[model samples]
Target: MDSNRLVAGITVLARGSQTLGTAPIPNPADRQHPGDGLEGLPQAVPGAVGLCLSGGGSRALSCAMGQLRALRWLGKLDELFVISSVSGGSWANSLFTYLPEHISDDDFLGQPVLDPSQLSLLIGPHRLDHLPPHNLGEVPTRLGLWRDLDAILTLKERHGYANDELWQGLIGEQVFKPYGLWQPDASGHDPRYFTWTRRYLQGQNGILAHNPGLKPGSFLCVERARPFAIFNTALFSNDGPDADLIPFECNFQLGVRHNFPAQPSQQGAIGGGLLDAFAMGGRYLGEANGGGWVSSGRPARPFALNDIAGCSSAAFAQMLEEQYPVLSGLVPRYPYWPVAERAEQDTLHYRFADGGSLENLGLNALLARGLRRLIVCVNTDQAISRDPASGDIVLSDDLPPLFGLQPFQPGLGYLPYSAQQPGQGAARLYRHNQVFARQAFAQLQAGLFAARQAGGAILFRQRLPVLANDWFDVPAQDSVELLWVYNDFVSSWWKALPFDVRAALELESGGNFPRYNTFTQLELSATLVNALAHLSCWCLASDSTLGNQGGLSNAQMLTSMFD
Candidate 1:
């Protein structure tokens, strides 16, 4: 099908819109549609820069708040183009953006408020006047756990007493609203989706008709500069020990293009990214390939907002697979049953989980938003270490693909991208993978094996995902320079936290949280302050022009770091 006659929300937003009130900055092609939907990655709008927050439970978000305060102090708050996150980090980003006037920079800079144990996060000592119920449980009773578990497994129908209601009500309504993040609707069937994502743009309300004035969160918006949030979920399972975990992109700005055609999904008739407007319109769609509308023959149901979070978080599936002995008996299959994947099956679990479970950070997607300079705030502690026997200093894998490089490699010292072309060398840059050519890679590989045998940092490291270095710098740019910031404090704090919180705080990928881990606001504030201090140092070192410079413009810093 031609691109025009496709799904509603699936149409690309790189195009201009009424809400944006500006023409789109044209592109040779959309990275999403590169040579028919499957080639190069998503392309960023020119000069667009995005921030990616790593998942480390609530402390991570609190820490992010601290960093935001620092950026504001550095006179660089509005300079950010996008901010993406997963899990608690999402909670942090959402709260930070939605809050209104009178929010002091010091509110974030001050000491984090906490109780004695440093176990539960507190609300006061900052702008927050009270603590929202971060989680809800009437206490799974000796009388109710099994029955409720069964009811949950049943379609069991949705948001029943079993699950959805508690989270949407207690979590989003209770915790987030007082903080100014989410706004709910009374008339709508799903309150979680009733929120109006406040994009600086004048976005249309896709759900206004059903629950007048209420709208589905915008999948994409353009009016104001905002960070795109990301959540990770297991899309496909290996049927055994592994899962195909992927990131889900979130933007509350809903864009509806006039006279625009939608695309066909290779699989379902109701392709993904369907908006509430079409679903609520009661329009009978012709067929699956034509658009995202439901079949005329069968009713098209409104997709739940939780589907957004559910698919983005695969915690339930992990519980079943891992079957931790303590909670194994409570694992129910009936009401919330994982039915066969066949169409005939009544329903299926979306299996959503944290993005960090897939990649330690959602930096991969951030690269797609058009950033010449990429900065990642990591939780790994210490970039340098001393060898116990020799006293020679060694570097940790705080930053892979970059730190994986060691002295004495096969291709020789300098990484020359245009070695084949003479004067072209000036235009070429260092290759991300080739920087650790064959010999260097083998040496790193050997060292990893030795460490595994000795039970060092990582007993076994998964094969690293390929970096999209080629995508970030843009066509005219020479090289993608990376600034690695390590926070040693998180290691101690994370290691000190309880096993459940540790599971939730996983810096690298792990299972999901049946319920999120606990973290003190004070701890989050302190950790964030430390991270921001590190970030401030880096910015000051780079002359606070890190975002403005890239490629050859950053040659000096690149040369020092790479060498």
Candidate 2:
């Protein structure tokens, strides 16, 4: 382990922060400022487009995939400044960011020849017998998925590990396979050879080789061809506010340079800082000659792509005891110097699970960035209820389960539900959206609402919150344009489908069109999977709300953010 080199890099960062007179947390008020490590990269501006993909197991993965297709069709994927994601949604985000250049171009729908530019062809009436292939290059057969599992088991047998490691191996093969990443211990090779480095995954000459203008001989240059990514994960700390609610310590596997302030009111609290994507798993040396800095300790192995994905999707981690425990994790944390530095002087081992353990929508990070234009794709659902009269599965008007914040959250206010489902009438949905929009406006009517109402802030101690106080030069409520896309069988999309196709889908889904079980239903039929993806795409492409009025489509509303 090259401790000297490791210390030198961290020393430079520490000295620079000291020179700046404070610990580094990206100041939320300064929208134009580029972060420390991201000096040369393109930083998102106030009105820049931000896409948030929420967590909900495999359902989120499929739904996000479809939304990506819609964005690709609109040619807006490249226009996005940030793509914040959590849990199963992170699975899709990881795949999108790391997919081989050729595979990524087609939106993982496996149909490139068919031009997606035309909305008619993209989501038009199609025969039930012939469904668009929604393959994201997953292992073709069950045996192949198990092959990596066997290899991981062998790797585990040779070297002691935990359930998180096993889960990472499985995801590497099943979720991110056939991309040349599944290089397990073959022919007695060193097990470290099996793990993938950040450079090898997205460096200039790596899988992101298709990205043009890549810095020559660079390993950490921001890959701008794709949206800057934040793979949000849960920080398992019982000390945080409302531990039962899983007050997430805002930690992320960031593709771009960013900082997370500890407190909502304090912009530069220095609570957290970026851990170089390459040095994420390295040991901390707080008691060293200088100050706290990362050290490449004995057996210095950098974090693998599988490790990041595993940590982000470790929803099982919430369950402390399991046949194979998943809650355990190891990720480097930047110690807040001088103030909180003493507590973190020694080596720190923080556990991270699914980002949904606290916030599910992935909106908090976007709001903290002060992005005015936001598109959030939500995939979570409440338990499906049965009708009292017919005793049939009720398939209408399932409101978005926004982490129990249906009507509103104090500082963040409320974003009207944009898209309508199979059951909601257009007029009824519009009225509901109008009411929420008015309520949000009412909360923000007073200019000093945030300063006066201390409890109004979106109080999650670990990361920055959407403070009720006016944090922006622009009115907090007036400047923001949020498009919330929940997973639902859109009424228009469903109606567009031919009668025969609808019947076939109803029979296949057993009357439940797109509201399939999340964690409970992992392996879904291809038809059901395509249906879910289709619903998500339509939801984003067609929905409207109070802010996005004048009959302007939701697609245009999202596109305007780029404009």
Best by lDDT: 2
Number of residue pairs clashing in candidate 2, backbone atoms closer than 3 angstroms, sequence gap of 3 or more or interchain: 2
- For candidate 1, the lDDT comes to 0.32
Candidate 2 lDDT, tens digit per residue, 1-563?
A: 33333321131222112111113323223333223322122334645778888877667777786788778777777667778888778777776665554444453653321211222322344322224323552322222223543655665576564544555655655665555443444422212211123433343323223223322332322222556566766443323432222222222222111222244422122223343344444444433333333433322343555656666776643332243343333221221221223234443344455666545666655554556667777575542233355443321122222211133323433234444421122222122112122333332223112211221111010111123221111112334566555454444456666566677668866676666665445555555555566666654454433233344565665565566
Kindly report which residue stretches of model 2 are placed more than 4 angstroms away from their true locations once superposed: 1-42, 107-134, 137-160, 186-224, 238-271, 286-300, 317-344, 383-478, 542-548
Find the 10 residues in a row with the least total lDDT in model 1: 135-144
Q: Model 1: per-residue lDDT, tens digit, 522-558?
A: 1222222332332323322323222222322222332
TM-score, cand. 1 vs. native: 0.49
Query: How big is the positional error of residue 394 in model 2, measured in Å on the Cα after superposition?
Result: 14
